[model samples]
Target: MAESTPGFELPLLLFAGFRSIVDQLHAELARQGHPDVRPAHGFAMQAIGRDGATASELGRRLGVSKQAAGKTADRLAALGYAVRVDDPADARRKVIRLTPHGYDVLARSAAVFEELRTAWAERLGEERLRQLEADLRTMAPPSGFRLDVAGWFGA
Candidate 1:
């Protein structure tokens, strides 16, 4: 008889898989000339979006404190990944937006993610990979996409 897997092993294995993918992605990103990008920055950039967002807005979207969001913005600016410009609608506010370099990183990240998925499919067999993804979708909540994962993890 086959032994049952422990419940604790499930989350651990899932996280390990995620960590492996993220680690590989970052390594590739560094090789592609974005050595300074961090996992948090991806969430931040998604929150910033194409239109941009004020610190408070970004903080809300990221589920972090305004101060935390401001710090992130500062770091992104220092890395030339983002910029803060005066808000046209609200003269009193500054909106954070991704720089061209930042957009390039996002685009490159997308391409790398596709490559990683293709690699996984090749290794696991396309059918098995598809089944795995289907199983995940069935198990996971239907929350669409969440940008607050960084804050949730931090909390």
Candidate 2:
């Protein structure tokens, strides 16, 4: 990634592994009847906390433009997972909140994550898995990294 030799390295390998894990997790969730939600969608969901968040706020949190965040909000609304309502405090502003179904998706995804972790441990030794997790946490976490359900399923 730096000005160096053009070959495989730790960063690339880590990215590939991250992508693989996310892809597999999505596939497993699909098998268990979760909707066609991608990791990026989880970002919007997370930004829009239970108290709700404006599209501007989501854009700030996601490091994207307001329009981009609005687009994501539009997609969530179209998917019946989110709704944009006028802020009670400020009638001119809009905030996004998850639908009951969206909450269900989050809950189900959490369960599937546990299931996947269990399966991985069963296949590749629980102690090794634990060490791997711990080692990752040991590495300096990048900016905006939160150890939450949605953080595990990152954008």
Candidate 3:
């Protein structure tokens, strides 16, 4: 038998695991009447919950360009999941915040995530999940990581 390369196997397995979890989450979301929700939207929701961010700040944090972040914000706004108000500090920039609906969606999603996480912990044992997290963190790039949509589905 040959040794696998240092970088390939871990990420492959990590993504496979994420796919399983996300599929389960989507099913749960659909049952809860949020069929239109997406992974990117969930990430944006969390970012809004954490802090009021400018689109450029979101772009920097998400490792995307400002234009890409603005597009995401626009979509979220169209869905009534976020609001953009003129930045007090900078007239040219807009501050992004969660609307009431956005917060409600995020709260529901968090509950679902917690339920799933607890079930997984019970099934796999908390120690095992912790170990897996540590191993994956060790393998990740220092700067951070991004899921490229173009490569994600072989598109």
Candidate 4:
């Protein structure tokens, strides 16, 4: 009979795999001129989206407090990744929008992720990688991706 894998190793392996990918991504990002970007920033930017969002709206989307979201927006603005502009419809409120630099970082990140996936496929064999992805999809929830992972992890 085949030996069964330890249940305890499953979550560890999964987390390690994720960490490895993220670490590599950040390293590449730094080399590509975005040394200030962090994992949480990516989640925050996704919450901000193309149309931009108010601090409260961003907070809700990211499952973080309004204060936390505001801080993130401040950091992004400082880094030149985002800007806070007057809301057109609501003169009392401000909206945070991704700057061109922010969009460039996101685009670079996507390309880097694709390169990483291709490397993984080459290392594991394309078929095996595809099978692994299929298995993960089958095991994972179908509710779609969430931008709140950073907040979830902090909690």
The C-alpha local distance difference test score for the whole of candidate 3 amounts to: 0.77
Total clashing pairs in model 2: 0
Q: How well is each residue in 26-139 modelled by candidate 4, as lDDT tens digits? A: 999999999989999998998999999999999989988999999999999999999999999989999999999999999999999999999999999999999999999999
Candidate 2 residue lDDT tens string, 1-155 = 66875567877988887777778778876777765788887767877878878988887777777887899899999988799999999999998999997887778777877887888899889999999888887895655365243334345
- Candidate 2: clashing pairs of residues: none
Tens digit of lDDT per residue, candidate 1, span 48-106? 99999999999999999999999999999999999999999889999999999989999
C-alpha TM-score for every candidate: 0.96, 0.82, 0.76, 0.96
Per-model RMSD to reference:
1.0, 5.2, 3.8, 0.9
Stretches off by above 4 angstroms in model 3 are 1-7, 137-155
Candidate 2 deviant stretches above 4 angstroms: 1-8, 142-155
Superior by lDDT: candidate 3 or candidate 4: 4
lDDT at 92 for candidate 1? 92
Counting clashing residue pairs in each candidate, in order, gives: 0, 0, 0, 0
In candidate 3, residue 16 scores what lDDT? 85
User: How does model 1 fare in lDDT?
Assistant: 0.93
Pick by lDDT: 2 or 3, better one: 2
Overall lDDT per candidate, in order of appearance: 0.93, 0.79, 0.77, 0.95
